[model samples]
Target: MPHPNQLISLLHLASPALPIGGFSYSQGLEAAIDSGFVTDAETAEVWIRDNLLHVQAHAEAPLWILLHRCWQSSDHAGVAAWNEWFHVSRETAELRLETEQMGWSLARLIAQMGWGDEGLRAALLAQSPVCLPTAFTAACVALGVDAREGLTAYCFSWLENQVAAALKTVPLGQVAGQRILYRLYPALQEAVAEAARRADSDPPMLSTFSPMLGVLSARHETQYSRLFRS
Candidate 1:
């Protein structure tokens, strides 16, 4: 069991309502819907599940875990290297911008909260564009959240945001959205477990191979009228 304070901190960090501007991004879901790729609740569920398992679990989550370890060990150089790698891994401009913008927001939030060592915070903020996972990991370390718990919360927060985006884009009923989230519970658990295991291996394997999502995000960049930033 986690300490009560740590659990509360995780909840706060993972909350969708946490003023991080996460609500504005569908992460290509909107574009996918407009393109008829995610036409209904079932399809929306499939799209989100595929992303959770393939893109996020294989790529982003492992990085998030590594960032957590880096922050915990005061590995500032490792944090910056991972952040740059994450920036480069983005397949499209919009996708890159999304992470950068969210990273800046989260980093500012952490600074405002007065967490972490000042020197570490300054070093992170000095990065040209802080990525979300790195900023989130730094904040978790500062707040004394366990790396596993932080990673779990990070994944869950992403799951919640994707589901929320689907609710609007897929126009699914609230109950249906809840059902989809419930069905994804196992996948979420598996992703967290895989991320933890991968964090232990040297030269972590990071994948960025979602061709369709990349295309959609690229298309979304010039979408005539859009509800999401990407």
Candidate 2:
């Protein structure tokens, strides 16, 4: 059982207010929006859900777990070691940036908190090429938050950002964005369960098998008139 302070830490780690500069990146929503594949609210919901489940869940989430385990074992070098797989596994440049930038920002923010700075800074300074989940998991642990709570919030926040991106780029209504978020709750829960299961697994196998989505991520890099990064 977790302590009261532990639970409070979990809440803070999971809260949407925790700044990792997530609102700036779209995770490929801009390209999907321009491509007509995600123009409407209904279509936008499907696209976001697909991304959360297929891409982030398998590819990025495992990195979080590995980073958490690395912290637990005090393998500062191991964090840097994981970057190779992050690059090779993720098929596109923009996708890589989205994760790394978010991870880096999260690391920087966590560093200023005056807690868990030693291991976290060492891991980041080693050029870990961290992803959002990687920074998120590390910060959560440093803050005394449990992994499950950390992951739960991470999953929800991912969805929230995508929905915001969709609302702006895809032109989905405010109400529609809420609907999309409401619909994704169950999927997030399922992802949390999956994350828990893979906590010990070594970077589980994953790829964005959604061909159209991958193309959009690639195309977003050159979208001459775009509002968000992939």
Candidate 3:
């Protein structure tokens, strides 16, 4: 079993109500549904799983691990570089805004909790945009969470938010959402492993090429009717 403090910190960081405004963005899931790509619970599960494997596992999860280590090692330049890379990799204006906005919100939350180091806080305040993964990694480090546990919590937090988005947009029942999350367990584990391996190497190149998702997100910017931010 994990240390009690670490487990509690993970739970706190992974909470859906973390006040980072994560609930507002579906990360293009709404657009996917609008285009008839993800309508039902099963389709939702498949869409999320594919993203988890192809996009997130390859990109953001690895970055999250890298940022976690940067925070641990006091590598401020690495943190800033990775944060900017993530911001630029966002395909659409809305996607970029979503990350920047959420990043700022999480940074503020850290400030409010008084868990932030002065240097990190100053860096975040000075920066025009801080990506969510960087802020979250900094938060985990401040809270004294280990990298493996922090990365797990980070992925799970994302999973929970996506599941909630599916429940609201796909109009899935609560039980169906729970079932989808349950089904994603294996993929989530694989993602954590992949991220760990990537983090062990020299910082890997960032890749955020999801053509279909890019199309959907771009279309979502002009969507006739929408329930999510992106």
TM-score of each: 0.96, 0.87, 0.95
- What tens-digit string does per-residue lDDT give for candidate 2 at 1-230? 66458767766765667776677778678887777777788888888887777766765665666767777676767766665566556668987887788778777787777667585666765665766666776777677676666677777777888888887877878998998899889988777666556555554544446677677778988889987767
What order do candidates take by TM-score, descending? 1, 3, 2
lDDT of 1 by residue, 1-230 (tens): 55558988998999987888999999999999999999888999899889988889889999998888888788889889999999999999988988999999999988888888897799779878999998998988888898888888998888889989988877889999999999999999998888767767786877788999999999998888887898
Q: Which runs in model 1 stand beyond 4 Å of their true positions?
A: 1-4
Report residue 219 deviation for candidate 3 (angstroms): 0.5
The per-model lDDT (C-alpha) reads: 0.88, 0.73, 0.87
Off by over 4 Å in 3: 1-4, 203-205
* Pairs in steric clash, model 3: none
Each prediction's RMSD to truth: 1.3, 2.4, 1.6
What value of lDDT does candidate 1 attain over all alpha carbons? 0.88
CA RMSD (A), model 2: 2.4
**1-230 in candidate 3: lDDT tens per residue?**
54468888888889987889999999999999999999899999999999988888888998998888888888888888888888989999999999899999988888888885888777666656888998999998888888888888888888888999999988899999999999999999998888777667764744787999899999999999999999
| Top candidate, metric TM-score | 1
